[model samples]
Target chain A: MPCQILPPYLLEKIAACERPEMAHAATAARRSLVHDAPLRRLGDRSLATDQPSPVPRIADPAMPVESGPAPTVDRTVSDAEGSENLPGKIVRTEGGPVTADSAVTEAYDGLGDTWRLYWEAYGRNSVDGRGLPLDATVHYGQDYDNAFWNGRRMVFGDGDGQLFNRFTISPSVVGHELTHGVTQYTANLVYQGQSGALNESVSDVFGALVEQFARGQRANEASWLIGEGLFTAQVHGVALRSMKAPGTAYDDPVLGKDPQPADMAGFVTTDSDAGGVHLNSGIPNHAFYLAASTLGGYAWEAAGQIWYDTLTGGLAATSDFAAFAQATARAAEARFGGSSAEHAAVLGAWKTVGVLPG
Target chain B: MKVYVSRVGGVAGIRLTWQVRVDDQPDADSWWRLLEDLPWQSAPSGPVQPDRFCYEIKAEPHEAVIAENELDGPWRELVDRVQRADTDSR
Candidate 1:
């Protein structure tokens, strides 16, 4: 704060000023330098940064340099013009005024919320943890039915509007796609079989967390819905998947029924969807819900930290449901102690979801 | 010959399948050419990205799995044509 009042140049001059009347000014300048020093060094990565960057957080005079990142929120939202072609036109950028296009504004704000959850809750810089700029494309296709992470950027479709609404309508869905980028950088889980399900589950876990963090909802108050508000009124569903009750999110004649399995017993064994990545993920999703809700506070605080640790704790890319359960268990113990309630909650949650031994 | 395309592994986790009886269509020659012109040599292989659709195509004797992200010009056209033909026949 003081850095803005006294420019670094002015502070330097004042620190060097030997006038007896300016002794306090020199002392204050030295303190500001220490307080404003960047806690984490940002690396040089050649990212597409055509938009305006965040207002630089100058070193404040009265604050200590905490262990959080310097907080870079570089976002770019483009439009596909109803075509499959990517990033058709730049419609919005970081810190820019809201656009008339609802999809573009929703995406920009959603990306910002996702970035905030990772940065504030876990102190992560971006998807790559290196302050990688986030880019998204909306209106990806005419009557398209899905959204996805293309290994580089998030792409959202204008849903057919018969069964689904626009993909950017729900913040959780945007968070879900962006978390795919997170999983790509962290565990890089093999996108097939149980490991693939874990990949999906991890995304859903943090996706819900992003929404919760933004809404300031406690664990109990949260919806635990992954794609809420994406379905139209005609679709008889509250969301695409419910962590609390996996297969109960939707059931409609046209859209069929939600096929997710809550625990291992009902887990669908199929060759579709990369060995049912979307189906089997309900197991871990429920596990996270139980752990977070059981702790009964901010879901992102204790439960989220454990999951974040396990994600970056270097599990194998081929980690299965059981291996992932073990990793989360160990992560909870490492942070909250084996005797602590947090570790117990994680183990209990996984056990309830049939991913761990009872 | 018959062609079947199934799209799977998207954010919604739903499978959508479309098929066409290549010989039954009035545009049979174009369908045949599109089916045969697939770039079989350059299949997608690398670290798999999350949530992108994986399309599985099954023809009379040939089958291929293509990632949506890697779906090139030919892949997109084949899918679009089959979807259109399937819708018309339905």
Candidate 2:
């Protein structure tokens, strides 16, 4: 869901000051885009593996930029030694080559910061516990409004330039994509049905934590909104997605209401896109949001701990929502006593989202 | 080495692609077998193209550099400490 609500063509019409006609066209376009069959069931796919042909690697030493001053970038998630550049350093408008003040730079900085955060805060070097050369592709498609960790590299679209700004600019978005890599290494959560949804939720949790840690904001002091600053003035949505509020993220008439279901019972049962993994993610997304808020501090410090443990531990890969909830509870208990605030936060967060751990 | 995994139906019906680089020479058969053993569902078919021997996993997204020794105990301890400290109250 990294793309903007309004498609570029329509936004262009509106930006061109075609008040009545362009607005009407944009509205119609939005409706069609929303109902666009492929988009509705995004990320829905049966987990089937294909043998990849090995493409020969020709190591070109020529592209080598001097490895600046021995580990110039701490490359650790929490190193705090790297530049304290703000997350919004990269910004892009109109889908032109990435501007220094555009979303791409922000994404690059965010990715590097997140990597450093994990390293400094936890001693973890990179997403895979290895120094993975972080690669990201910004401005993927023309007005192509989505950011994805396409399994190899992070690909971001410029957003239609009207409603959505640049996907790479938001630290949360960068975190979201990078967390996908973490999931891949850990549970490799089945990207279908409830399991798929949990995978998405994990990304959301970690993504928010990256933001909270960078800003030095505690849970209460934080907004708990996923893509708060992503939308422009024309966007009628609150953010790209709301972990705390779930379905309440947006309710604009033209863009259609947010379709995330916050409770287990309300879990969406669909087969369109990998069993609606992204759609059903709302339930777990809400759970993590509540857990972090209840824990009441830097999310990456407490709530992030439990979730990360669950992911890397035996609960990986095949774990579903119920299983994930149980695992999180166990992790909390193992990390903190069963009655500790962190443990309580874990339990309360799941319950708030209608998931009662057994 | 660039490994390409093609799932008949990828995540959300979109083809899922994972590319990884290994320091050693590329081995197709080994990579395919490894991918087959991955936790997620993998396409069951003949080798798509270049056949070599290597470990493979159905890739989803993101990037990483594995130095073989990276997953040793020291790395595990480092990750575990981070996980525990990041979540436990200061």
Number of the top-ranking candidate, with lDDT as the measure: 1
Which regions of candidate 1 fall more than 4 Å away from where they truly are?
A1-69, B36-48, B88-90
Report the CA-based lDDT of candidate 2 relative to the real structure.
Answer: 0.57
lDDT of each: 0.80, 0.57
Chain A only TM-scores, each candidate in turn: 0.81, 0.71
RMSD of each: 12.1, 22.8
DockQ category of candidate 2: incorrect
- State the lDDT of candidate 2 residue by residue for A187-260, as single tens digits: 78876678777877887787887787677566888777776767767757777577777777766644567777
DockQ per candidate: 0.52, 0.03
Q: Candidate 1 on A1-358: residue-level lDDT in tens?
A: 2224666677678756767677546545543432332211111111436523322332212122345446679999999999988878998888899989999998999999898788656657788887889999999988888888887888999998877799998888888888888888888888889999998988898989889877767788999998898889988989989988899999887567899999989988887677889999999999999999898877877788788878888789999989989988887765555566888999999899888889
lDDT of 1 at A246: 94
TM-score of predicted chain B versus true chain B for each candidate: 0.87, 0.24
In terms of DockQ, which candidate is strongest?
1
